[model samples]
Target: MFKNRYLYIFLHIIMWLGYTALPVLNAIQRDTSKPQTNPYTNPYYWAYVSFSSILLFYLHSEYLFPKVYKQKPIRYFILLILVIAILLVGRYSARINFVGNDINQTLFYINSFIQYLYIFGISASYSFFTDYQKQQSTKRDNEHERLKSELSFLRSQISPHFMFNLLNSLVALNRKKSNLVEPVLLKMSDLLRYMLYEKDDKQISLDNEVKYLQNYIDLQKLRFGDYVDIDFNVKVPTFSKNIEPMLLIPFVENAFKHGVGMIEKPIIRVELQTIENQLLFIVTNKFSNDVQEIKDGASGIGLTNVKRRLELLYPEQHSLKVQQKDNFYTTELKLNLRQVA
Candidate 1:
């Protein structure tokens, strides 16, 4: 960082030198018809240029740049006008000295004016750049904070949604005195164990995630037998891998809630496939216009939070698409799996 700073300052000095040299150096070098003059080759001219460059750079770095935040607009405006007027006077004095062939006077006045302008302009530009950078930095920070808050809200909603449905299943079974109650109870208990303990992590083994999803599907299948149909097809390698736990369940839940809730004979299709360093998930649900109005989650949140989570966790590595046409709702998600591995 320090090296970069030095390089930046060195470059700025070179830029000012180049700008100043353009008119003066060209006029001196191009006047071939004039007699040999020692003024062009004088050491005094070089010294003046060097001194002016250093002073301007120091003013910009030490005072103008740092003082921007402290100065009110009215005060700053007044200071700028004063500096401009001083620069004009200095330039006039330098021009007269040069006309009189007084090298010392010319250098003192002209170089001072040029240096003042260079520093003032450069400082203003530098301050503008700094303000731009600060604005971008603030925007990025706000986006990060928003994404974090959204993820927290989504996760909270997911926990309760899973529990609420499981409890309903248990309650229904208890009312009917069904023989499947005991096994379903055990499955629910196991699922609760995973949700409570394992899901605290940001990620879990792919095998474990698949197992939990299977159990969840089985539990739901027990509730709606012939009236509902579920087809889950997953093609994955038998390798040790990890995934964001419960990430796919919300899509599945969405299907069950809308697809099978009001339809006479609803079909829910889910497919999961992983190849190399990517995971693909596609869920399609059949719903009718007769279905009940979509209900927001407990805290008046919806799938927007899920979308936000995908952005934060996956960023450029994932793609999500929602398509609604006629009576079908389909969601497609493709995630790059290499990072988790």
Candidate 2:
């Protein structure tokens, strides 16, 4: 609310104007007056009360509230008593000029004290509420920036692993002087271009992501040839949905990395489809019990990295499960396709 300067000021003016005009409204509404007329009806008394209320409100809000309420509670109580005494005495003095000596001073002073306290309390509460709101907004902004930085770092980790795998494929082709080298290098160029550009976006069309994956698979096929059997199937909506970039490739990469080496008749299968505005993807690879996971500093950002990205980007909108059973390693993911704010 405080973010808009003009609106906040206008609201403040409207509220105080209504409060200041209340006595005049009451005076106009009265059909008759008592034989001993009340001081509240007098324009002078009304003007004096309005000034006092406004003064008390601003004084506490601008000056005393921060120091007293935030820093020293005991001092606030003591200073509050002084404030009440001073304002009460001033109000009583102003009343005498209009009301004369006939009124009870003690009762008037007590009532004046209560009214001044009411204004002070309102001012303090308003200030505190605004400050609290600003603090919470700051915390949320900080958290958002923190998450953004972490996500960028995770994406960076993916780049080297991807480049390393593609480079290895190119190396194998170049060493053998294969005719497919040029085409594979061209495919790698497309993949590299997409990684260099599209990976930075918060969201990209699912079609683009699918194309990227196809390019990666083509490179892998060009490298492995008849030695490995790989199948990739995709069914998606005609109207493309949005998805986080670099989200689906790591699992398929893992399949290609481990499923082919020294294993008999190696096979890797990957399938993706959208049903009822939800994405379902599964990657399965046949693995020999003897084939072990290779660990290195330049290795692919594995399941843990992808899992964390899923938690951050999709939260409750996604589910992931990984299993090794009956000599097959399987990773399945279900993700909501709805847009998020």
Candidate 3:
């Protein structure tokens, strides 16, 4: 506002003109027809009220407000009292010199000081209000930046976590000298491509994400080679809904990592379906007491990272339940999805 010089001057002129017109409006409202009893009939009365008000407001808003903001109340009060005293004298002289009859100095000074102080109060309130708005805007900006940073950090963690688990899968093939390494590497390339290209997106089509999951499952099937029974079911009415990328991988990965080794007739079940913009995913697997969740101190990151991402991205819009019962581990996720336009 201050940078626009013409607008600033125009607004101040309009405001002060309205201020000067107030006494005349008041006199007209009171039916002050006799010039002897009418203060508005005198041109000096306009100066007395309008000039003092504008000067006092400017002084308070510009100089006195800075003093108060800087915690210099003593100097502000002293300078304010001096300015009001001088304006009061000017008001008294205007009344005496113009009307010149039955002039009570005390009452006139008192009323004029009250009016000046009211303008000062108004200026102070304006300063505080503008300052409060700025503070709230700054606070909101800082909060947005913090959330963005946290989500970025969370996204950065996914690539390494995924690479680590995938390397273990490939290592198993190497140890066995299996011919499946070639297909697994090709599938891994596809997964890595999607992960690399789509990691920066806030959301992605549920169709593409589901395809990524299918590729991962296929790779896993190649690695295990019929040793583990994996049932993956997916049902969706449409493919236009959007989901956070990499949000659903952890549970299925967790099942494969902790459910397969050292167990007879190992089984893993994954169910994904969407019902009118709501997504439900369930992963259940058979596990033994000996096949604990901890493996190389990193089996926990998958679930833990997904949980934190769910909280940050979905907030109150999702439900996740993880439990183990009857030697079976299960994780259920219900997410509210965004439909495409």
**Candidate 3, after superposition: displacement of residue 191 in Å?**
1.0
- By TM-score, the candidates rank as 2, 3, 1
**TM-score of candidate 1 to 2 decimals:** 0.67
Candidate 1 displacement at residue 263 in angstroms: 5.1
lDDT of each: 0.72, 0.83, 0.86
1-341: candidate 2 lDDT, tens digit per residue:
46788898899899999998875666656736552365667778778888888888877777677767679878887887787788788788778887777778788777777788789789889879877888899999999999988888888878887787778768877887588898898998899899988888578888888999898888888888878888999987643688888899989988987898789999999999999679999999999988677778756566668888998898899999989998899999999986433
User: If scored against the real structure, what TM-score would every candidate get?
Assistant: 0.67, 0.86, 0.82
Model 1 C-alpha lDDT per residue in residues 11-69, reported as the tens digit of each score:
97787678655646765677756623534333444445445545555555466555743
Q: Flag regions of model 2 displaced more than 4 Å.
A: 1-31, 34-36, 67-82, 175-177, 339-341
- Extract clashing residue pairs from model 2: none
lDDT of 1 at 19: 66
Against the true structure, whose lDDT is highest? Answer: 3
